[model samples]
Target: MGEKSEANSVAPSARGSLHEHHHHHITPLKEKKFRWRVTDEHSPPEIYNWTLYLSVFVFGILGSARGYDEGNISGTVAQTSFIKEFGLKSASLTATQQANLKSNITSMVQLGSIGGCILAMYTVDRFGRIRTLQGVCVLWIIAAIIQCTSHSVGQLYAGRLIEGFAIGQTTTIGPTYLSEVAPKAIRGLCGCIFAGAVYFGIMLAYFANYGTALHVVGRNQWVIPTTIKCVLAFLILVGSTIVCVESPRWYMKIGNPEMAAKNLSKIRNLPVDHPYILSEIADINEQVNLEKHETEGTTIISMIKEIVMTKSIRYPFFAIAFMAQVLGQWSGANAITIYSPQLMSLVGITGVKSLEMTAVLGVVKFVSAYLAAFFLIDFLGRRRSLYIGISIQLITILYFAIFLTVVPQAAEKGAVLTHSQDMAGKAALAALFLSGTGWTMGFNSIQYLLGSELFPLRIRSFAQSLVMVIHFANQYGNSKALPKMLLAMNNFGAFYFFVGVMAISLCWVYFFIPEVSGRSLESIEEIFSLPWYVIGRRGAELCPDHSEVNRVSYNVEGTGNAHGGDIDYETKPTAEFVENASNEGLMKSDSQSLEK
Candidate 1:
């Protein structure tokens, strides 16, 4: 007893002496260097400053480039003058010829996008996001050059393929970069920027095409519109390469804490010693170390296996890309965006007016998407936002269905049709604009952010690739189907088909998806464990205080002296288990459907 007492007494003194010696050795410079104190228990930085938002905004702008590439082609292709210059006159051309030409163009682009999405998954982690984006942009420039100079339809298709590949890479990678870099509080808003930028790009494309189509540039005028888009894309590509900062999380992944700290400080614009910054950096490091493999290389086989075999990851793998591609394509969005001018012309509006209204629709999409970013997503959370937007989408589609089926036709019996047949076109346009707003407001923002978050670090690339493949499948369908749909069913039949799909998708979300707003990236793993009902009902526990849960919720049993609050013994479920219970119905239905 005496010896133990003496040892205990000496331990404090020794510790104190060591502490004092360490204190003495820490110079002012060294103090500044290792100033930010963080442990696993703490949360990351909450407050965002102007500089951080500005830096992220630049990323948003770069994302807009993808949108520009997508939107430009649709509007430019519609102008009659462009058709004439491209020798698309029906009097001289067969229906077979037009179908073949459009199918060839759409197919090539979709295929290229598939390649880009898959390639980016592997290359992004190795070369870093910025460099990969730079490569895509360079390809865009080269493709644009080819497109502008195309003497034959085959060359145009080839150029589109290359452009599609670049777009595919940018669209997939940009959101991944944005979500990782953004703080949780504003992540949804930052996420919306990609959608907004895309709509804005489309709007810009429409406006540019409209102006160029009207330009007095002598003989062949299609050259100018394509040229302008290529120039803009090239400029953004170059600008982003020089100015964009590497994602702080990415820096941490590469085993460089100093650079990570420096970048974090720049991103947050907080002092280097900020508690939140330190916490985030530590969390990222912990995650990377915990997840990284023994080998440095991320192999293709491992990537595929991680997605398919892992129970925790497969759901998100299917969900996000499915949502993006379906909503972007099947939910009538791609068909609408690509054929807005034609839809308008069919309704009653045509020529300059149809083009102008298409531009207006693009603006509406931009504004609504930005508003979704600013308020709805962060405030209401992902599932609620999705519900609200999708509900509105359903309602809009219903309106189109009713109008299409019941509304009187424009051609009065056998009267000579002097003007463009417009009643159907107008109704379709109204429905499209309304549905688009809903699409952007909910699904567009959530899919990319949610998809990126759902997969584990090991499976992220494969999952993204798989989802994108699904997405392009829908894109290919919509692109090929639109003209045929328009020709066969007319506006009403085409609009109703998408309406039915939206209704089906809405049910999918209501039954299966868990709300995931304000949750940390790591916590997303829990999605697989909770019962789907529990997830849908409880939503995710967001921004929980990460301090000692025991201290916070201690149970006092059969004791006079009590400490803390009584705690429930119930343990949280894992993601895999949760998904199984939640998805039992879905699994059965899918099996039955497959059998049928």
Candidate 2:
């Protein structure tokens, strides 16, 4: 941790002249030499920028509810009150009921997410991120209203479908909104909220379920849980309506430069003449120019094709898509989140005593996820966290698999067994806590950050939309297959299956996922150079500067192969890189001269 902090401390000054002479360069320190304030950090406090913090907080709250809803359902059903009230009691009613509830809830939510994601992608620039977030919060309210009045299972499913759309939209746009608005130093951590909120939601659900089910919440039991979720979602809607600000970058993209500059200053808590603010505005202008060219000649389909066909673009896609899903999911993380109680039972953790142990596991998950959020943007950076987290995940799952193997009875008899071996079971419980700890370290935090960072600004929304679609598909598949896999193959089969996937995923990550820890979204070319094959072979050591930092070829020659050759870490490229006329006219001037 100290090592990374030291490296970052050296970053800003380390490359002082790297691109300082570019066409558009601004330094507030030189231009506003006489005008100084005593702010500790670069930006002002939230009090002065209360509107911005309020906006982010509101979205965070709304987003958190969606996560809570998704996570809570399993534990909610596990409650005796829910099982009894919902008629999920009889052996005949169990399988079909469980599958139906799972499918109806998850599918509806995911399907809505697909719509929400699509809408956000097209309309974000038009309506703005804050507006979209505020607007989508309405879906949560409507879903809540319908759920509160639901008389049948069918009605609940309808509500879930509506809620799903809102959740999908939130996932697609929320991270980008946070990333663009946050300071560069904390951007990774800011983006980490997308996943952190989900885990927080899980924690909320766990505690809420325990509070209402275990404690006394009155006669109309499940009503309190459902109603509380509804109210929280509604409050998010109201709060966002009152306080959220539109993204400044989104404003610049749509030709509202004045408002963009104004909002940027407001959100960033900067003086109008701040140097970093000037850089931000310059970057926005660059983006605007790029967008203008795009409007004249590009179609979304063509853009998608260009990205896929372009070797540089395809590499990040392969890395993120493979790692985000495979490493994140292959760890059997979701199973623990969605089906821990049942899993505990399978592994012989049952009765009141077992529930207490599971509670400890939940707390560990909560604490570890919090640790991830703290380290994610600040200490580990994005790619570093993924590397360390994913590596740990591989090791833990292997051990988990081994643990399941050794305790063969955990498979055949279920986790809830007779008390003949209480001491042995206690040891097993400790192991379970360790497994949960491992999961939160990498699995919980990596998903959202990787999804958000793996694409360029132009295609971020679309890429994340596609990523979420796969995410829910996998969720659906796992939810459907898991119980049966557990019962049929028993715990051993389930563990082995996930271990196989994790092994393959680790290889993909080792080979492909680039270190994007602290780079700007505009600087994605670095990642583009890392092909899946290379990532498999070299890991982060590929970058001449830092193994994790990806690089791009700005060389007009189009043949320098910044991404292709054995990485030249020992020597640096010369400055007099000539433009290659033979290169396609699509090449930009800044192509070569990309620095270490």
Candidate 3:
């Protein structure tokens, strides 16, 4: 895949002119001017404009809408009035019945999300990213309205399932859209924003729940949160339609390269002929062409077969994509997010205290996700971030196991916790806080980032849908079974299960995941095309030789002459170079001239 080819070398004078003229536009200072203004030491800056940032911001809020739905129900279900109003607290209900009802209320969202993921798989590619998002935003609003006005349990369940479907779509598409449009230099950070938005939504839901619980005296406690989510959904609906631009890749995939180029130019605030803009388009075309060549028939079954059966593509690409979600879901992150109040009560912190603490957990998660998006992801790089964060999560879950073992009574939900039990409860809360932080820093965000980058454009939406289906399946199963697990094995046993799962996850990541911090989307394809065994420990070092393929050079003199000039050039290769150099020996004569 990294093999070089031959092409004609331009004359020295013409080549020098091309190099010098293009040089001014690709400089470090010029690149920094285009980069998103964020304080991070590790990530090199690249070109970005307000159009791209605005689109990303809107998508971030879309993610927050998903988070709001997930987090709001946690607090809503905890309300005394909500429980009584819905017969969840009725004396006729057995312990088993109550647990089932609580599970249904939360797990239904996962069911809805699964449906949404399937819907997005078809629509995102057919209707384009922005259009699909707009359609789902309307669905979300309808679901919210149904929830706000529900008079019975059946109606509430119906509303929640609908809401989940929309969220599921948004969660998958938002990151997909952002990944397709973001600059390579800050792609990880941009993807992290979607994850951070989820935490942000969770935080807002917690605060709303806490405030409503204290101030509102009736069923309105739950109703207000539902209504707020509805308003948010409406805003997203309007904004997505009016503000967001269509993904350029979607246009290119549909064979509308002209429109794709136009949108790309608009997003980058550059002319269609600008080297960066041209390079991005060429890169997309190169990847698309590769996919076309590999899967000639291009049917659903064939794509799956190509991804699963082909060794060169499967192990490092599809398998890694699938496991990224597995690690995230199996890490017990969603178990904690959906059941924080119940989890807290098991550790002897019940009543309003539990609600307050859940809100604080939300704050911690939001802050951690925010920090990871702006500072940690680009700084630590994706591979190291996943390792360190998962390790922290493992340690925190281990703490939970130990705390529950030492204070067995604390594992009994609704028990009147003693002073020591209270101390143990605080410890458990701290551990939960740490776990949430760890998840946001790595697994929570990196899963989406990797998913967006791993699959070829031909199968990206479908592949993401497949992964999301697995993700939501894990979430649904976990949400429904967690309450029962706590009852059967005690809180200690549950944490012990998660601890073991995370430990294995740590090893899997260390052995399989590769570093893709600053690489371009097209270049990522070449990295995966390498031998699978070589991808583990030194994957970043072994990536397809990008030196000449995408390398761009600049001259300080701003003149066409290469002699007696102070030159500043980027080793980063362009898409045209990558494609042209594939002709065998294209680099033979110009290799020295191309060198800085």
Q: How high is each candidate's TM-score?
A: 0.79, 0.76, 0.87
- Highest TM-score: which candidate? 3
Report every candidate's CA lDDT: 0.61, 0.58, 0.74
The residue-by-residue lDDT of candidate 1 on 246-298, one tens digit each, is 77667666666667767776776644433344345545555565566432576
Total residue pair clashes for candidate 1: 12
User: Candidate 2, TM-score vs. the true structure?
Assistant: 0.76
Consecutive 10-residue window with the lowest summed lDDT within model 2: 578-587
Residue 408 displacement (Å), model 1 = 7.1
**Pick by lDDT: 1 or 3, better one:** 3
Give the alpha carbon lDDT tens digit for every residue of 351-380 in model 3: 787789889999999999978887777766
Residue 7 accuracy (lDDT) in model 2: 28
Q: For model 1, where is the 10-residue window of minimal lDDT?
A: 579-588
Q: Residue by residue across 1-596, what tens digits does model 2's lDDT show?
A: 23223323333332333323322322222222211221123222321356666666665555576567755665655767556655555566677566565545544665666566666666565677867776776777788778667657678778777777777778767777876676544556566666667767777766666666666544344556666666676777678667777787777666676677678767766543333344455555555556566656656787679657877657666556645764565567776677766766655665444445545666777677767766554566554565666566666656666666666676445444556544555565566667666666665666666666666666666677767666765665666566667667756678777767666765655656565554555554554566556653453456433211122221222111122221111012234222111111111223332342
How much does candidate 3 score in TM-score? 0.87
